[model samples]
Target: MCGTANPCITLCAVLVGGIDGLENKLPLVAGDCQREVADLSAEERRGLRVTTKPHISIDESLREFQSDGALVRGLETPLVSAYVSIMEE
Candidate 1:
């Protein structure tokens, strides 16, 4: 969690498809993303979450997304490695 000042999970609401919804939207499951996301000090991955709704192992889902289809579907955006730039001010 990024603290009350920034509730990142709420942001996940609209991301899931209307049908697939949370199922289709890729979330940080396990491995480095878990620690990496927790270690983040804001302005990193603003819209991050630990989702179990999909039921798929975190690592497997993530690895599946590491491919090119994830890009074509717009499910895998390039915001993970980069810092969150949007400002609330």
Candidate 2:
């Protein structure tokens, strides 16, 4: 099933990528929509490359979530961990 089929997985995956991007100081790439992203040439798309792991399993995503710097300040680690654990099940 697609990740979007599970809201939990979808949200967690986005969070993982966002955290990684922040830590790496990745630049943002603006695409109007899926069509705009798809219309870009291979070279153009490469410019937006933040991570090679475009799709990851929930388990992989959880590992990132459990990492020391995965979440930003103000987000309680215990709560996030509990939430992710429930989603993984």
Candidate 3:
């Protein structure tokens, strides 16, 4: 699944299965770390090597899935306890 060229497929799989499905494939970073990335200045974000423009708008694609009933629910709220646990480490 990780080798697929289409990121949307990967995202859809993750969305359907929840984050636990990614436990082996990726590290579980704290939600605060994610928020910090989101809060980064545009210039700071652009400086991150992993950042790239999506070929299609992910929000729009997700909306299409919602309209088609492919996605049963929206994303889960960030796990604050998980963040605290990470901080304690």
Candidate 1 residues lying further than 4 Å off, grouped into runs, are 1-56, 68-77, 80-89
Clashes of 2: 0
- Name the weakest run of 10 consecutive residues (lDDT summed) in model 2: 47-56
The TM-score that candidate 3 achieves is 0.22
Q: Give one digit per residue, the lDDT tens place, for model 2 in 1-89.
A: 23434576457657877877888898777443354543556766666662243334767656765674645232457766776778678
TM per candidate: 0.23, 0.47, 0.22
- Which candidate number has the best lDDT? 2
Model 3: residue 24 alpha-carbon error in angstroms: 18
- The numbered model that scores best in TM-score is 2
Cα deviation of 8, candidate 2, in Å: 9.5
Candidate 2 or 3, higher lDDT? 2
Residue pairs with backbone overlap in model 3: none
Per-residue error for 62 in candidate 2, Å, reads: 1.0
Q: What overall lDDT, based on C-alpha atoms, would model 3 receive against the true structure?
A: 0.43
Against the unseen true structure, what C-alpha lDDT does each candidate score? 0.38, 0.59, 0.43
lDDT of 1 by residue, 24-70 (tens): 66454433355544455554444443333331354443344344343
Q: In each prediction, how many residue pairs overlap at the backbone (N, C-alpha, C within less than 3 A)?
A: 3, 0, 0
